[model samples]
Target: MRPPCDPSKFVAEIVKNVPPSGIRRFFDLVSGLEDVISLGVGEPDFITPWHIREMCIHSLEKGQTSYTSNYGLPELRDELSRTYYRRYGLDYDPASEILVTTGVSEAIDIALRAVVNPGDEVIVVQPAYVAYVPAVVLAGGKPVIVSTHRDDEFRLTAEVLKPAITSKTRAIVLNFPNNPTGAIMTREDLEDIADLVAEHDLLVISDEVYECLTYEGKHIPFSSLEGMKERTVMLNGFSKAYAMTGMRLGFAMAAPEIIRSMMMIHQYSMLCAPITAQIGALEALRNGNDEMERMVREYDRRRHFIVRGFNRIGLDCFTPKGAFYAFPYVGATGLSSSEFSERLLNEKRVVAIPGDVFGEAGEGFLRCAYAASMDDLKKAIDRMDEFVGGL
Candidate 1:
């Protein structure tokens, strides 16, 4: 008989070093509880628009279940190209510059792999999505974190970003309308960073999945900046904007060279994004604009209400200009972010994620997503108010 294999010894050091997702733990804890009002997960509460769903269903009925080309359906790529041109004045070749992946998650993974070499340093703005640093590490790269402050509306400016650069730095992962903070970079703000990128000759992976959900000014695509198109790999999808998170459809746009590099990794691993999801996404681009607009308007209303409510209850929350989260400082309650989140879950049956999970800079805040319904948001606020009063 063969000896039993030792799993721990066989695991890669990089995989072992990465911590489990902080968001997932809270989600699992809340799953078994009763009457828990959760504002922890960043997913939209809205279902995928009915018309998009119907299109997907129709495609399935027509037996369009075969795998698409490794790059993706040409029709979907063409739609994406047109959409980018219409929205951002950025033109990409549908045949060579676009590659669809399972989701933005996969796109990030492939983009990192394509650009990062061993010992390469990737600058990650803190209070970022949980995946960025891990993806960099998995690609055999080092992550250099630059913390953004609430005083700056959590925007990453060139001054703050400059000090972190080194000879080893190869790329920067930019996520505007950022997760956990809902911070959006203005055109002027991005110009500063673009100057640095030009000076350093660094690649940029721009995650714009939340592009459509900005409540303030229009979102400026980083690739739209002068000279940035050649260096940027733009990643976006149907998840947040269309409430199609489960559909797992996302695409990357870059110069042909970068897209081809990313495609090699994707073809070996994922082969292609789901055809049904691709069909749905195509419909979303073609006809779901009004429904997408309606969802954004509703999210804006909830954003205002939640920010106002948090301030009224003595939790100092900065009003976010984009995305669906409110990052409120929880220090006034005399508890660390984790402590507050724990007590809120155990004592009040409300769920909110600790800010520090994103990075050390997130310590004093808790990320409260406003993607839930108005009723749930109100209930969560009331419970939180009572909890704060007792504290």
Candidate 2:
């Protein structure tokens, strides 16, 4: 005589222990509403450019729907090898070191599962992507959070990171041009931590999905630093850069042994990234740069406009140098992050995610994505002005 829907009876302990994504919950509130200008999710507003979609269509017309090799399409991996080398001057073998994942999401999951032993400690920097900490917990590792401060421009420094290390610490997850904060770590910023990673012999799981969207500085791959490539599992994806989120393609690069380990989990769990998507991704790498840059330029414009608008409306907003988000301090409204977001939605119909959803360190801020149309951005800003002015 158990209750009808008891979590303890039906769910795994870890599954029950971890709460559902706070971002997802906010999105759910907006789902039934009409004319909502949602800045909640961190997804691009651009469509996959014509050529990438055309390639997917061409694949389907050619009956190319079969499962790809468990590792991924070889040709796609080859193209990725060329792309990374051309951009970062880093070399990863197409055969043994590169893995095309279902998305960067799956890449993270498999990589964590492959490396984490039960109770091993993994460092997750906050305010972090919603996925990182949960992914670590699900992989059987204890997540050790290191909060990055707004005063540091949200950069994680070696001096701040040194005290967090211990013998149980197995790895650290690094995301630059980060979501929520839209913060980027420059080469000097990253080099400081690279030295620490080297000193402690810690592994790095670097998610550089937003690398192409960097505005103020050149993007530097963590693996490019001396003595770090062998210890880093680097992940990048088409979803962010190419605006191909629906296609669900991403790739991971690491040493041969690590690649093999991740591939085993991937084979059993996902088998392969879709064959049609692989063909599309290959086409994207070959010809999508200009279109991608165009989108980035537009985002750059919207970024400035929204940030200025937020500041003018009396919110102290940090100007983000990369990605398409503006993190505005909403404490001026005298509300908790959730309270501010709920009140805004109920009163203004504009959707900015409550920053505490990202992490506890994010409680006083609101993540406003600039990925919306300029018209929407303008109206959202105007509405925000009214909302704050009334308060």
Using TM-score, give the best candidate's number. Answer: 1
Clashing pairs in 1: none
Which residue ranges in model 2 land beyond 4 Å of their true spot?
1-8
Write candidate 2's Cα lDDT for 1-391 as tens digits.
9657755677789987675788667767887888888777578999999999998998899899899898899999899899889998999999999999999999999889989999999999988888999999999999998988889888888877889999999999998888889999978878889898988889999999999999997988899998899999999899988888988999899999999999999998899999888999999899998999999999999988988998898999888998888999998789999999998998999999898998998999999988888888998998889999898
Provide the overall lDDT of each model, using Cα atoms, as 2-decimal numbers.
0.94, 0.90
List candidate 1 segments past 4 Å from native.
Answer: none
TM-scores of the candidates are: 0.98, 0.97
- Flag clash pairs in model 2: none
By lDDT, who's the top model here? 1
TM-score of predicted structure 1: 0.98
For residues 109-210, could you state the per-residue lDDT of candidate 1 as single tens digits? 999999999999999999999999999999999999999998999999998999999999999999999998999997888999999999999999999999
Error of 1 at 157 (Å): 0.9
